[model samples]
Target chain A: MTSTDTTTAGKETSKPTPQMEGTTKEFYDFCQKKELRFQCCSNCKQWRHVPRLMCAECGSWEWQWLRSSGRGKVFTWTVVERPMHPDFVEDVPYAPVVIELEEGVRMVSWLSNCDPHEITRGMPVEVEFDAVSEQLTLPKFKRRNNPL
Target chain B: MSALQNEACIVGIGQTPFLRGTDDDCSSSLRVELQACEAAIKDAGLSNKDIDGILPFYGLSIAEDLAVNLGVRDLAYQATSHVGGAGPGASVANAANAVVAGLANYVIIPGGWYGYSGRRVRQIVVQDVNAMSGGKTARDFYFPFGLTAPVQWFSFIARLHMMEFGTKPEHLGAVAVAQRKHAQLNPNALLRDKPLDMAGYLASPMISDPYRMFDCSLEADGGCAFVVTTKERARDLAQTPINILGIAQGQPFPADDILTREDPFHLGVTDAAPRAFGMAGIEAKDVDFAEIYDPFTFQVIQQLEEIGFCERGSGGDFVADGGIELGGKLPVNTHGGLLSEAHVLGMNHYIEAVQQLRGNAGERQVKDAEIGIVTGFGDFGDGAIAVLGR
Candidate 1:
C-alpha cells in the first residue's frame, strides 16, 4: 500500500534528501512504485539490502531486483530524543527500528504507529509505503497483526 | 615477533589547550594543526627538516599542506587514513611501515578540528553526506528515518547489547564515572574541574535512549600530534621512546552498513586486536593498560570486549566493579579518554598511550606500566589497534 499524504511530506523540506544515484537510486525508485525490493544475486541466489552493484558472497555481478516479503522482526531500535536536524525537531522522541526482513537482510526504517517506549526486539512488523515527497517514497513498518 | 615490532617508536607528543570554545579568528583548523605539529617536532628535539613523512587524519588534515607549512626539506612519504576516528591509531601502523621500510626517517601524525566552535561534526556530516566513507547508505537509508547522528546510530547497537546481555544503564554509568574520575587528575582534560558520579550520570539529559549527555564525548576546539620514528632514531631524540610493539586496522564485512553485519557486536577492533597482539608476541593479559576510543560510554565497554580485556559480552560487568579504574584489573582511558577529554579525533588517545609508556603521566599514571594498548573506533565500527611498550 502507498500513501498519498503529500501535504505532510511537503512540509519536511529541511529533511535530508537522498542522493539518488546508481544502485541506491534504483532501490528508492522501487519504493516509489510501492514495491519493497532488495538486490538478489541471479547466479548464487543471495539477497542483499541497500542495493549493491555486485554480490559479496560469490563475487558475481549478475543481480536482479526481487520483491521482499515485507514481513520482518525488529532486530533493534533507538529512541532519538534530540533532533540532529531542524526538520526533525518536531518529531523528537521518534523510534528508528532496524528490521531483519524474512528475506535475510536488514534495513533501517521507522516503526509507524508505535510509541517509542513500546518497541522491543523481535517484535514482528510489516512494511507500508509513504509518499514522502514528489520524488521520494519511504518504506515504513507497522506492527504485524499476527506475529508469527 | 614481527620485523616491525619495536622498530618504530613514538618519540614526541604535543597538543593544543583543549577548549570548549575559541575566538572567531582562532578557529582555523589548519592553524591549530600546524601549531600541534610544530610542538611535536620541537618536543622531539628535531627541526622541520627532520620530518620526512606525514600521515594525517583524512578530511581533517592534509599531508601536503602540513608538509609545506612545517617546512619539511624532503617530504619523502605521505598518506592519509580514511577510517574516520580510527585514522590516528591506524596511522601508527602506517607510520611504522614507513619507518621500518626505510621509506622515511620520521613521520608525524597530526589531527585537529574546531568541532565545537566552527562547523560542528554533525553539521559537517549533514552538509556533505556523500563525503563520509559510508555516506551513500546514510543518505539513502538512515537519513530518511531521522537517524542522522552517531549517537543515534550507535544507540541501536547499545540497545541490542543491553537486550541480549542484560547490560544495565549502571554499567554504562560506571564507564562515565570511572573516566570522569580519571579526568579529574588530568589538567589538560576539559572536564577536569567537573566531577561525574553514577548519580550525576543517571541524572544527565538523554540525547538518545540509553545514551545520556554525559555518556557522549566532548565536542571541543583542539588539536593533538605525535612523532613516529625508528627505535634506533628514538634513542638520540629528546624524550624516552615508547616502542611500537604492534598495530593493526580492520573493517567489518560490510564496513559501510552497521545493521547488515553478521554480528552486530563484532566491530573492526574485533579483527584488529588479535593481529596486533600477535605481531607484538603478547596476549591480552600482558597488557598493562588500555587507551580505548570512547566516543560514547558504551563504546568503551564494547571495545574492551573486542580488544580482549575481558570476556565477550562481559564488559558491562567488567567495568561495574572498578575494573577499568586506575587501580583496577586494567586501567582504561588513563588520560580520561574522549568521554571526558576533548575529542581531537582520537589522536589524544594515542598521545595518552605514549605518555603512560614514558612514565610521564603524573596523577593518573598506571604504576609500573610497561605495556599498553590504544585503539581507534571510526566510521561505522571501523577499528584500529596499537600495542605499545616501554
Candidate 2:
C-alpha cells in the first residue's frame, strides 16, 4: 500500500511485465497478492531470485517459496535518464536500486520514498508493492527506520 | 600446452566505411558482412576457392551463406565464438586452433552491423533484452521494476567502482577525450571531424548517472573482417603477417548475473589476461600497444588494470597525464575504438592491431610496433584476449 504510483511518467508506454510463465508464475502471483517472496533451497538454506527450480549453491531441486521480511539495504543503484525504450520515455530520471535483503539474497527494484539525489549505497530500505496493471504488480523499496 | 601458438597469422584486413548514418536504401547486415568478407578475401590475394574455413564472431556472417554467395565448390570448416562483444578476439584463437588441427588452411573472421541507420526504422543495434540471462535470470526480477539496458547495469558497476577506488567521472572523460584525439588522426573514424573535449564530455546530458553521452560508443553502420592463415602462407600474401602469439577466453562466476558478481569491479580479464600472456610467453610490459574492447570509457581503465598493465585499482592513475596517448606507455585504441570509430563489435580492434603490426597504418600507426594485444569484453562479464606480434 505504501508504493506510490508512477504511471504519469509515460502513458503510451505500459509498465513492463515479468515473464509470468514456468517457475516465475508463483513469484508474480505473490506480487499481485501484495506479498514479497523469494525461492530458498531446502538443503543449504540459500536464498535466490528470478524463481529457479534448482539451487545455485547446493544443486537442490527440493525448494520452497518463502516470504521475505520485506527489508533490505541498498547495495547499488542507477538513476535512469532518457531511457532507451520509447515505452519508458516518460519515466525518465527514475532510480532503480539493487538491494541486498536481510535473508542474504539480492535483487533489483526501484526506490519509492527517497529523492534520487539522496540515494546512497548500503542505505536501509523496506519493500512496497505497486500494482501497475490489473495483472501486474512490482516490488519497490522505500527508506526504512528501525525495524522489528 | 601452447597448442595453437604461432600457428596462424593475420594476413589481410578489410572493412566498409564506418558510416555514422547510412541512407535508407543501404545494404542489409548480411550484405555488409559479405562486402567486408569479399574485401578481406581480395586483400589476402585469395579467392573464393581458397577459403575452406570460416570462423565468425558475434554471428556476423553465416559461413554457409557466404560460401553460397561466393560460389565456393566446397567449404571445409565453419565455426563461431559466443559472448556479445568478446567474440572477435576469441574467434581469432578459434581460427588458429582450426589451422593447427589441419581442419582448414585459410579462415576468415567477419563481423558487421547497420547500427545507426537501422535505428531509424526501429532496428537498434544493441537491444537491452533478458536473453543473456537465459530463460530464467535476475533480469526477470529486475526488468519489471524499470531496471533495464546495459547502461543501467554498468551504472551500477560505475557506482561500485567509485565507492571502491574513489574513481572520478573525470577519469571516464579522460578516456573519451583521448580516444577522440586518436580519432582525429584516423580518416576512417566516424567521429574524426567532430571534436570532443573534456568539458564537452562533462557537459553532455547524462544518459544514466555516471555515464554521459560521450561515455558510450558511437552506434554506426559499418562492417570489418580479417583473414588468417599459416605464417608460411602469410609471408607470400598481400601484406606482412601479424603473428598470433597467444589467445585465451575467460568468464566471471555466475556469468549470467551481473548484480551478483563476486566482486563488482573484478571482471573476466582477471583470468583471461594470465592465460593469454602465458601462452604468448610475454608479460604486460612487453606489449607496445593494445586495442582493448572499449564500448564505454570506464572499461578501458578497468581492462587495463585487470590485464596487469597497471596495479589493480590504479587505472585511474594510469590514464592520467597523456599516458595512454601515442608515445606513452601503452597507446590503446589508436584507431579510435568503438567510442570514436564505429561499433562493429570488436572486429575493428583486431583490424587496428593488424594495421599497426603490418606497418601500413597511415597517420595513426604506432612507431616501431613490435608487439600488441587486443581484448574483447562480452555480455554479463565474459572476456577474451589475444596477443599478437610482428
Candidate 3:
C-alpha cells in the first residue's frame, strides 16, 4: 500500500489510496504511465469505465484498453464544505466534478485550475495527470479554453 | 395484475426509540434488532414459532442469527436485500412475494444499526466503499477525489437539477421545513422538538453545496421491523391489515455510476413508479400520502418527480406552497421521514405508511387517507416502491 502523509498545524493526516488489485490495478497502472484509458469491448466497440472484465452492452469478455482524449465537459459538480475524511480537512471547500468525456464515459475527478464557484454545467475541461505519490498518478482536470 | 398484488399485507410494526445517544440496555445492533423483532411478533399476536421467514438488510444482521435468537424454527424463506436504504421497502416486496408463493406463511423484515453510538455512515463507507453493490467503481474512481459521502455523490444530481430545471435552494428548504413540521407531531422523532422554518433551514451550515445540515437526515441509533402475512390470515391478526396493493424495485441503467447515466436526473424510482402503480391498478393521483425515503432534502424532490407525483422539473414547485405538508394535496413523510425522524434505513417509512393506512397516525395523519405510497432509494439511485391501502 502506498500512503502520503501531510502535516497541518502539527497534526498528521494520511491520504486515502485505492487498492491496486484486479481490473482496478490495470487502470491505475495506465494512469501511472500518464495515459488515461478505459476498457473498450473488442466485440462491440463500446467503451466502459472503472475497468470491468466484460462489456455490459454486448456481454463479451473480449476487450482491450484504449486511451482517452481526456477532453470533456463538466456534467455536474459539488463543493464539499465539510471534509468526510481527515486527510481532506485542509482541502475543505474543494470541488469534485463529474466530467462527461468526448468518448461518452464519465468519471469523478477534481478541477486542478478552476475555482469551485466558477464551475458551471457543460463547461469544457481536459484531464491533467498528477503524480501524488511514487506509485500513484491521478487524472485531474483543468478548464479548457474552447470546446473541441 | 400480479398474484402478489393485494395478496399480502403488513400486519404489525415495531421500533426502538429513536435516539441520538446510545442505550446501554440495547448496545449491540443485534440486540436492538431482536427487541424490534420481538415487539413486532407480539404486535402481530404471533409467537416466534409462527414466523417462518426472514428478510434482513444486507450486512446488518443474518437471518440465521435473527431466527435463532427469536427461537424461530423451521425457517423456510430467507433472503437479504442489498439496496442500501432501499433494503427495508424492497424487502416488503420480497416478503409479499414469499407469502403469496407459499414459501413462507409469515415473514419478518428488520433493519437496525448503531449509526450514532458506534461507527457513523461515513466511517463505514470510508472503511469499504465496495460494501455497496456495484460500489467498486466508487472506490477506484470516486473516493480518490474526496467524494466519499452520499451527500457529496447526490449533490451532483442536485446541482444538475438546479441547472436544468431552475430548482432553487429555497425549494430544497421546503422539504426540510415540511418534514420538521410533521416531526413535531411524532413523539418518536429525533428532531420533533427542533421545529424549523425556511429561514432556519437556510441558516443551517452547509455540509455540501446546495445541501445544508438541515438538508441531511438525522444519524440515529435504533432499529425497526414489520411483519408480513397473507391477507386472508391478516384478518385474524391484532391490527388492521395494510394491504400491499403494489410493489416494485428497480435500478438505474448503469446502476453503479451516476454520472454516466443517459439522463442525469433519472433515478431508479423513474423505472419503478410506473410498474408499482400498474400493479396496484391505480395512478399517482390516487395516493393520499407518500412516505418517501428521504436521506436528503433534494432526494425527496427527485423522488417526487420520478414517482410521477409531479411532472419532471416541477417537483420543486410542487413541494413549495404547502404542497407536501399535512392537509396538502399530498401529505408526505407524515412520521417526519428520515429527515426529521431517525433514520432506520427507511424502515420507519414502512411503519409510518402502515400507521397512516390504518388511521392510527394521530395529529399528522392525512384525513381520509385510504391509500398511500412508500419509496426507498439507495446505492447510486437504486429504488423500490410499495403501494399500501386499507
Candidate 4:
C-alpha cells in the first residue's frame, strides 16, 4: 500500500455540494453547453442576477435568460486558511474570491490560474467552468491568461 | 411607532470583567449576567428585580438554559435573536418593541457568555453536526486543514479586501492603533497600551491569511446588559438619560457566493442602516459619535460608508482625516470598543453609546454628544443597528 488513506471514495459533487435553489432546467441545459446565462428583466430592461425570478429594479416577473459574456473583474478576495465549513478540509488554504463583473454583478467563486501567493487586489479574472461532478459543474474563475 | 418614532431610547448599560477563562457553571455565568444587570440598573438608578422581561443573546450556548438558571423572578417575556453578535441591537429592539406594544415594561436585554471558552461545554449543535457528517461542506473544504474558528473565517475577508482594494497591513494597524489609544483612557478595556504598529502587525502570528493576532478582536469571557424603559421614566430616574431613538436589521439578496462578486466590504450595513436612519429621522452626518460593533478591524471602514457617514468607497479617506479618533470631527468606539476594550457580545457598544448619550463615559466620553449609533453584525450575514439620544 502507498499509505494513502482512501482515494476512490466515489462521489459526484465536490465540497459545498453545489445544489441549485432558484436555478431553472433551461439554465441547466445551457450549462451543459458550457455557456453562462443571466436573466434580462422585461420592465426595467436590466439584467437580473443570482438568477432570480423577478427584477430587483422594477419588481417585474418577466425575465429572459441569455448567455453572458463570461468576463468580470476581481472586486475583493480572501485567502481562506480557515474553512468556513469543515467539508472544505481537503482544499485547506483555498482562495475564496469575490469578483465584480463589469456588468455590475458580484459573485463568490474560487480563484485559479495563478499562484495564490501572487494574488493582489483588482486582479482581472475570467470564467473557467469545469465539471466537478457528473450531474453538476461549478463555474469558478481564474486569472486572465496567467496560469500558475 | 410612527407617532413616537425616534423617541424610544436605551437608558442604562453594564458589563462584567472579561477574563480569558472561566470554570463557572450555568448558574455562575448567570451570576455574572445578574452582576451586569445590577450595574446597569444602578447606572440608571433603578431596582434590580424591576425588569419585566429578559432578552438574552450571548449564546455561550442558547437562551432556555441560561434563562432557566438565571432565576429571573416574574419573567413575563423572553426572546433570543439570531445572528449571534448581532443580537445586542436586535435584543434592544425586541425590548423596545415590548415596551412600545405594552407587552411588558422595563425589559432587560443582556448579551453574555463566551464563544471559545468551551471546555465545560462541547457545544451540542446537533444540526451543525449532522450537516458536517453528511459530507456536504466545511469538513472537506476546511476542517482537516484546521481552519476551525471564526477569526480564521474573518481572515479571508481581510485577505480578499487587500487583493481587491489594495488595503495594506497598515490600514488594519491604523484601526488597531486608534482603538488601543482609546483603550488607554478606558479603565475597563482588556489590552490597554501594548501598542501595535503596521510592522508589528505584519509580523504577528497569522490566525488566518491576512488576519494576525492584532487584526482580530480580543475575545475574553465577558458579559454585558442594558435596561429599556419609556423615555419619560428614564428622565425621572437619572440625571442624564439615554433614549433609544431607532433600531433596524436586514439581510442580503442571497446570491450564489461561489458564482458572483460578493462585496464583503459593503456588507449587511447597507441594508441595515437605512431602516435605523429612517426611524430616527436624522441624516448620518448629524450624529456626533458612533459606537459601532467592531468584531474585526475592517468592519469599521465598511460600516462608516454604509451608515452614510461618508460616501461609498471613501471610508479610507474618512479614517485618513482622523474622523474616528478622539477629539476628531466624529469619535468612534470611544470606550475602547470591541477591538481594544473587549469583545463583550457587541452589548458593550450599547453600553458605550448610552454612556456617551448620558455623558457618563468617564475619560473616554465624547464632548456634548447627544446622539449615538451602535451596530452589531455576526454569524452568516446578519446585522442590527440602533440609535440612542440624550
Candidate 5:
C-alpha cells in the first residue's frame, strides 16, 4: 500500500532544516534555484557525489557543477519503520533510496509519491524538490511515469 | 612465510567492566581508556616504561601522555588509523609491523569508550551529529535526507542482500540468536542473561526496516587493550603467547561512498581476508573459530560469506542450523561480540581471540582452538582482518 504521509510531499517545509555552509552551501543554493546539480570531473568526465575538490580518477583539481537529468533507478533502499529523529515522526515508515543517477553518479534521497511496498531494485524514478526551510530544499524521488 | 608471521604475539589482554549505563565513578572517556591501558599493562606484567610503541584507535592521541607518565624515555613508534571501528585489527597489524621492524619492542593498541555513560547513544533527533563528529562530506549529503545513524547505513546492505540473494529476515535473525547464546555463557556480556529467539527478533520493534532492536548492537561503556611483543619474548611472560600469523587491511574501490561500490553486497573484508589467510600460510578452512565484528546481525552474515568461509549469497545458509554456534563449523564471537557483549570498537574481538588461544576461555571455549580470525569494519566500507594462532 502507498505510504499515507505527505509531509515530505509538495513544495513545502519539513521537520528539521539542514544547516548549509561551505561547499554544502553551494550545493543547496542550486536546489533553492530548483536545479539538481553535482560535480563532474572535466579531465576524466567522471561523475562524483558528496562533492569533492579533486577527482580520484585523474587527480585533477578541475571540475564542473553540471545539472542532473533528475532521473535514475533505485540501486537499493530501506524503509525507516522507526524514525530516528523526532522531526521525522510524522514521516514514519519512509523509504530512503540510494538512486543511481543516469549520469553514473549515486545520491541518497527520499522515495515519495508511491507505495513503499512498490519500491524495488532498479526501479525507474525522477527527482522533485521540496523547500524544507528558508535556506534548505531537499531533493526527493517518485516513480517515473513515462520513459525518456 | 612472511617475516612478520609468527614474529609478534599478544602478551596480555585487559578491559574494564562493560556497562549498559554510564558509570558514576569512571565518568570520563579518557578515564576509561586510561584504566583499560593500565589493566593491560598490569596483565602483561610489565611497567609503563616497557611500552615503546602505541597505537590508539580512539581518544585524542593520549599515547604520548601515557608514554611519559609510564616514565618511558624513548618512544620509537606511535601511530593511529583513521578508520574508527575498523581500526583495532589494523592497529594490531601495525603494532606487529613495528615490533618486527625493530621500530619498537612492546606495542600496545588501546580502545574503549563511554558510549552509554556519555549519552552519545543515537537519539531520535537529526542534529549536527555527523558533520561535527567526523566532518566528512558524505555526512553533509546523506544526513540531510534522514539517512542518519549506523543502523540506517547497515539496513541499506541488508535490504540489498535480501533483494539479490533472497536472504530472509530469519537468515539475519539466526546470527542474533547464535550470538546471544554465546553471550549467555559470557558473564562479562551486558546481555548475558537475556535470551532471544527468531519470533522475538521478528517481533522486536523495528529501529530501521530490515533491522529490529535485537539486530543492532548495544550502547555500552567499556574499554579493552592488548600488548604485542616478539613471540620469543612473549614466551617468557605471564600467559601463553597468541602469535600473529597473518594480518591484512583492505578497502572497496572508492572506499567511502557505499552507494558507489561495484558490488553492494561485498565489503572491505572481501579483499582483506584472502591476503590474511595467505600470509598466515593457511586457508579459510584452517580457521578453527572466528571473532567477526558484528555491530549488526546482517554484518556477521555478510562477513562470513565474504571472508571465504562460504560462497557468496550463502552466508544466510552458512549461519543457519547453528553453523556459527559454539559447536558449529565455526564458533564465532565466542565472547558475545559487539552484538551482545560490548562494542569496544572490535578490540574485544581481539581480546577474545587471545583468550581462546591461551586456553583461558572457560565456559565458551572452542575446543582445540589453535587458530582464529578477527575482523573489523568501519569508515564506510573499510575493513581489516588478522589471523592469530598459538
Candidate 6:
C-alpha cells in the first residue's frame, strides 16, 4: 500500500521506442533500417508487443507489419532505487512502468524525462528511445498529454 | 495400516557440513547425503549395508541422483514424493507405510541440494521429455500479470492476509528473531551469535510487499538423510528410539477449477490435521512441542489457524505469546529452523522432532517432553503432519 509515484517532471516524451533484436528476418531488416513495425494480425488486424507466434484471440498465425502510433498510459509501476543489473546502477530511482497502450497491450518499459516522484498509476504516456549500446536502443516512456 | 495410526519411528538421521559453497552439481550434495547415511547408520548402531528401501523428493533432489551417488548396489523399493517442502513429512510417511506393509525392513530417505552453492537453479533444468513449459490454471491465467517467482506468488497472499487481519510486519519479524535466537545457542548454526533485532529487521531489504530478505529460506548446499527401520530393529540397534504415532497429508485443488476451496480455514492444514489427530488419538493441545516448518512467516500462521490451534485469522496473536520460543508451552525449532538455521529441505526439522522426544536436544531441550508434532508444507499445496512420541 506504500506504493507511490517517484517521477516529478511529468513531461511529454515524443518518439518511437526501439525494439529488441529483430523478431523475424523481415522485422530485423526493418529495425536495422530504423523503421518501426509490428505484426498486424490479418484475422484480428491488431499489433502486439512481445511478438508472439500466433494471435492470442483468433489463434491466427497470419500477420504483417503495421506501424504503430507508439502511445500509451501507465497501468501500474514500481519505483526501484536498487538496480539488480550492474548496468542499471546509474539509473537509480528509475520507474519501471507497466503501460497499457491505446491498442490494448501492456509493456514494462522504463519511464524517463521525469523524476520518480511524479509517476502514478494511470498517467498518460508516450514512447521514447535511449541509446544503450552501439547496436541497441532502449525503449523508454514518459508522461504524454492529450491535445484537444 | 490402521487407517491413520502406525507404530513407526525414525531410527537414524544424517546431515552434511553447513558450507557456504561446494563443488559438484546436485549430485555432489547427494553424495554428501550418502556419507551422512553411512554415519547415521553407525549412530543408530546398525550396519550401513542394511538399507533396503528409498524415498526421495522433488525439486533439485532426485532419488536416482542419490542412488547413483550412494552407489546403491541394489534398491529393493524406491519412490519420490511431490510437495516440494512436503518432502520430509510425505517421504517419511511413505517410508513408514513401506515398513508397516512389510515391503521393507530398512528404508533410506535422502534430500539435499547445492542450496547455497551459488548454483543457478532455473539454469540447472533437466531435459524435459514432455517439453512442457509454462503455468497451469490460475497461474497460467495470471502469467501475463507478472507473477512468476514464489516471492511474487506469495505477495498476493501476504497482502490479503494483512488486509483481512491486523497483522504487522513486526509480528512476522518476531519469527526471525525467535528462530535466530535459537540458532545463537546451536554450535552448527550458520548465524550463531549473530541474532537480529527490530532495527535489523527494519533495515533488511524488502523482497516483496510484505516479506523482507529475512522472510525467505536459504537456498544452499547441504544433505539430509534418514534411516527408517522397524521399531523392533530400532530398539535392538539404538538406545533411544522415538516413536512415530501418526501421519497425514493434504493437497491443493487445481488452480483454475476452484477459487475458494472450502473457505480459507479449510485450506491445506485442515487436510493434514484431522488424519494426524485420528492417527495419534491426540488433540492439538497434546503436542508437547512443535517443529512446524517456517519457509514463510504467514504459512506458520496459516497452519496454526488451519490446525485448530486458534480461531481463524488469530494466528498472529496466538504466536505473539512467545509460544514458539524455547521455554514457551510448545517450543518450536529448538535447532533453529529453515528461517534462522540452514535449510536442508526441512530434514533438519524432522531430526529436531526426534531429538526433542528422545531428550537429546542439549541446551534447547524442552522439559519432560513426551509427544511432539512436526509439519512440512509447501510446493503445490502438499503437506505432511507427523506425531512422534517418547
- Per-residue alpha-carbon lDDT of model 6 for B1-390, expressed as tens digits? 463264667887777776667665554455667766776677777765577787865654456666665666567778866566777788778888888788888887777767676443322311111111222321222221222244434443554566578777877777777778788877767778687986798688876556777876656567777788668777787647777788888865422112222243344557888888888888989888888787776777777777878887777777665767888755777777877778777888877787778788888888899888888876434577888887
Which model scores highest in TM-score?
1
Interface RMSD of each: 4.4, 5.3, 1.8, 8.0, 5.9, 10.8
For model 6, the docking class works out as incorrect
Q: Give a tens-digit lDDT track for model 4, residues B4-52.
A: 4655566677888877677766433566676787777777777756677
lDDT of 2 at B34: 77
Clashing pairs in 3: none
Candidate 2: residue A82 lDDT (0-100): 66
Candidate 6 chain A TM-score vs. reference chain A:
0.72
lDDT of 5 at A102: 94
- Restricting to chain A, the TM-score for each candidate equals 0.91, 0.86, 0.90, 0.79, 0.85, 0.72
- Residue pairs clashing in model 5 are A84-B124, A85-B124, B22-B117
- The candidate 1 chain B region of ten consecutive residues with least summed lDDT is B123-132
Q: lDDT tens string, model 3, B1-390?
A: 688888999998998888888745434589888889988989999988999999989878899989999988799999987888878778988899899999999999988888888777877777766557756767778888898889999988898899999999999999999999999999889998898999999999999898899999999889999999999999898988889999999999788888788887788888999999999999999999999999999999999999888899999999998999999989999999999998889999998998888888989878999999999998888999999999
lDDT for each residue of candidate 5 in A54-95, tens digit (9 for 90 to 100): 998899999888999999999888888887765567777787
Model 6: DockQ score: 0.05
TM-score of each: 0.97, 0.93, 0.96, 0.76, 0.92, 0.71
Candidate 2, superposed: residue stretches over 4 Å from native: A1-13, B24-27, B120-139
Q: Candidate 3 — number of clashing residue pairs?
A: 0
Query: TM-score for the first chain of model 3?
Result: 0.90
Better structure of 1 and 5 per DockQ? 1
Q: Give the poorly placed runs of model 4, Cα more than 4 Å off.
A: A1-75, A81-93, A99-113, A120-148, B26-35, B42-49, B58-73, B119-167, B206-209, B235-239, B255-265
Q: What is the lDDT of residue B361 in candidate 4?
A: 77
**Best-performing candidate as measured by DockQ:** 3
- Error (Å) of candidate 4 at residue B177 is 0.7
- Candidate that beats the other on DockQ, 5 or 6, i.e. the better one: 5
DockQ of each: 0.58, 0.47, 0.65, 0.19, 0.43, 0.05
lDDT of 1 by residue, A44-86 (tens): 9999986787889999999989999999999998888888777
Where is model 2 chain B poorest over a 10-residue stretch in terms of lDDT? Answer: B119-128
Query: Per-residue lDDT of B273-374 in model 1, one digit per residue for the tens?
Result: 999999999999999999999899999999999887888789999999799999999999988888898888888988888888888899998999999999
Residue B239's lDDT within candidate 5 is 76
Model 4 has a DockQ score of 0.19
